[model samples]
Target: MPAPIPTKVHYHKQARELELGYADGQSYRLAIEYLRVFSPSAEVRGHGKGQETLQVGKKFVGLKDITPTGRYALKLHFDDGHDSGLFSWDYLKWLIDNREANWAEYLERLEAAGASREPLGIEIRQL
Candidate 1:
């Protein structure tokens, strides 16, 4: 069976979300930050297993553009100057199915590494 592709794609800049709709009346709204942090690019996923790079300070990342790569994938251009990942239909579906678990794991990893999703600079201190 072939991987399901989104029938409709809409990027909500103000909401910083990408809404993907399918023919079966199912739709998913994925946050831009989530997509960026979990990008399939080599910079994020790395060259092999256990080589994946943990993405931090990407809470405010935004999508600069989204281009179709033939009929199988999407080339996402991020405002942070990252434009590598080729989000295939299969990968997108996987992401949708694993969204919750992946996000939770990412959070756990961040905590373990003492990393903040907040952009590189500026700190939040409570007195």
Candidate 2:
């Protein structure tokens, strides 16, 4: 089945949150920091599933720029010198819907592995 179309997008600079609204009368929220840290770029996501790199100390990160890639994706340039990810529309929607669950899981994994987003740079906060 085809994906639902998005009707609107809102970026709140003060809240550092992005809100997405769909034609199906659903809305999703995604934090700027979360999006930056989870960028799908190889530099951040790594070569494979287990090879992912951690991002750290990016509470203040923002979208410096965004370039649309066709009709289905966007190339984001984060303020923290990361510009490699091509965020597909579907991925963005998924992140918004699963933000809480995904973040909680990532936190658990970080604790288990003694990984710090600030230190190890994937799952912990330094600032």
Q: Write the per-residue lDDT of candidate 1 for residues 1-127, one digit (tens) a residue.
A: 7778899999998888999999999999999988998999999999999999999988877787899999999998988889999999998888899999999999999999999898876744322
Off by over 4 Å in 2: 112-127
Question: In TM-score terms, which candidate is top?
Answer: 1
Q: Rate the local accuracy (lDDT) of all candidates.
A: 0.89, 0.76
- For residues 1-127, write the lDDT of model 2, one tens digit per residue: 5456567877777787777788878888788888987888999888898898766666677676777788887787776778889888888877877888988877776677776555334542233
TM-score of each: 0.92, 0.79
Global CA lDDT of candidate 2, please?
A: 0.76
Model 1 clashing residue pairs (backbone) = none
